[model samples]
Target: MAQPLQPAEPPKARAFEAIVDHIERQVLSGELNPGEHLPGERELVTAFQVSRSSVREAMRVLESNGMIASRPGDPRGAVILAPTSGPLQKVISRLAQASASSLADLLIYRMTLESSANSLAATRRTEADLLQLEKAMARMRAARAQGQEAFSKADLDFHDVVANASGHALLRISAEAVRDSIEQLIAASIEQSPDDHALMQRTIDHHDQVFQAIRDQDAHLAEHLARSSLFEYYGHLLAKDEQIALSALASFGSNTR
Candidate 1:
């Protein structure tokens, strides 16, 4: 009689994942730092005892996470960066183009962040910070009167200035990173929709409220105002989305005739 065969166990990971793990260990061990150039592909292959294709695949993983930047022109072609939210933002932007996410989702995240920033600013804002905020707001008002190009630039400047004024480096960097990623989308949406006027008015009003709260040293009021403004924007977006869907349905009916 023949002996029975034993069942095979599942593998720990796929081949690419194994390569990814090996590189990740190096990163965690302090072997990599921002602006530090990675070894060339052939060198990496030898160092890891892996094939060149595996090395390439591992590089792709790091690049996708904003852990490394490939600068082919530089003598040091593959420089590492401290990981940032940039990779997540880039992926989100691409997905948003396919309607995998909505503008509302982005707005929601901003609402959560900016409301906290408002509270912090109420307690922490210095005279210099207030001056910066006032200057940015003035620029926005002037740009709004001029046209879209100026308006967009000023809009970015105002938000960036406000974020910086909160005295939180991490918060400012995160907000700016997301803003950089989706700025084109934001401009497009504002231009295409009648919601532009509504948005601008709300922005102006909330900005004034936030500024006043900070000047008064009222953290609670600032947070409340920020949350209220976000909710109002959310409602406007919801109504606009419904109207768009209805219009599309009517158009489809007409086309079928």
Candidate 2:
């Protein structure tokens, strides 16, 4: 009656995914530290009872996901890597460019991230952080005649300082990831603008407000300003309906509007 156990089902877990998950769990759980070595390929192959190719595939996933450094034929095995935003940024950039809806999605996510980062910066910034912000702003002003490339770098530097000042690593990383994802779109707008100098000047002026909010430790105001500034800079690219939806997210009150 058991029908010969219905011919035992194959294991649902894929061999390579098992290997990847095992290592990732160890890394996340702190059993494996950054710069620590993963077991040798031959050893992993034996331990997992999987083929050498499975082990190599696992290594590829780990490296691509920013979890390790692997090189074929390296006797040292794969070294654990410190966390980074690079992989996340790549994924976001890919998705943002995939469709108009995705573009809107990324813009909203970016605005939310910047608002939170600015709020945190207001509450958490150290004197050193403010100094960095000031330096970045000064670079922005000086880069006026240096062209969009330099000004863009300076502008990014200012945001980077705010992200760093937030004192939240994941927040900083995610904000950077999202910012970088849509940077190309923003850059293209700047490049095509008839009055790029006026555009940069307006940006500098808005950033001055942000810098003052952080200096004054005005968290809500800082958050509101951050979102508003981003909306003004990029909202035109979105459809009118999308812009309307975002305006609510961007404004704190009529004052910000």
Candidate 3:
């Protein structure tokens, strides 16, 4: 019988991608700890048996992903960075501002994440967590006279605490990413409000109410408040269709509230 020829494998676009995968796997597997330096380019090139250009390209990709930081004039190559939501926030903001439908999608995601996070925060928050939330509230109250910028920072601090108290790391991470994206998207617009002080006060009051609900362990109320208050703050910026899509979330647990 004649020998059969097997099908050829697909071609890779570049050798650098393989290098990228190797470095990412090391980081992910904990073999490469945060703050550790990656092997110098010459070392990487020799180990991977690829050109220095390929190694450099892989470093570029990793740096852009927020996985590592490259210091100029440093012989240490790239340094590993602890994982963070910064990249997620950037991507989310980009997509949310792309179109009306995309904005609606992001809003929907925020609603779902916040509602679940608030509910869990209500059920699972510890005294220390509550103290953090109170600290955030105090900052917001103090920042009220300062300006929207300060108040906004304090506002984010409050939700970050709520997200942490959820006791779900993934939820907390995603919620923080989504919250950052949403805040960045609307911050300039919010600053343009005719009644800036009223808007700021309302924000503080709504957060206060949500905090009380969580303190009481009223999961339903906390969830409802999170969804409803978010909608109230940003719903007007959305089109009518988008509003209709999000209104259900705001009202979903109203009976319990």
Instruction: Go through the candidates in order and give each one's C-alpha lDDT.
Output: 0.68, 0.87, 0.87
Residue 90 CA error for candidate 3 (Å)? 3.7
Candidate 3 per-residue C-alpha lDDT over 144-212 given as tens digits, one digit per residue, 9 for 90 to 100: 899988988899889889988998878877888887787777667653679889988889889999999
Say which prediction, candidate 1 or candidate 3, comes out ahead on lDDT.
3
Off by over 4 Å in 2: 1-10, 71-74, 93-100, 184-191, 254-257
The stretch of ten residues in a row with the least summed lDDT in candidate 1 is 248-257
lDDT tens per residue, model 1, 1-257:
99888659765675567866766676778876677888887787777787778778878887887777787777654887875657667776776677744565555556567767877888898999899888877886776667666776887776667677788867766666555555656664543446666556567766877778877878877766655664554434445764454333223322211
What are the per-residue Cα lDDT tens digits for candidate 2 across 197-253?
998999999999999999999888899888888788778888889999988888764
Question: Deviation in angstroms for 181 in model 3?
Answer: 3.6
RMSD of 1: 9.9
Enumerate residue pairs that collide in model 2. Answer: none
Considering only N, C-alpha and C atoms within 3 Å, which residue pairs clash in candidate 3? Answer: none
Give the lDDT of residue 223 in candidate 2: 92
Compute each candidate's TM-score over C-alphas.
0.65, 0.84, 0.87
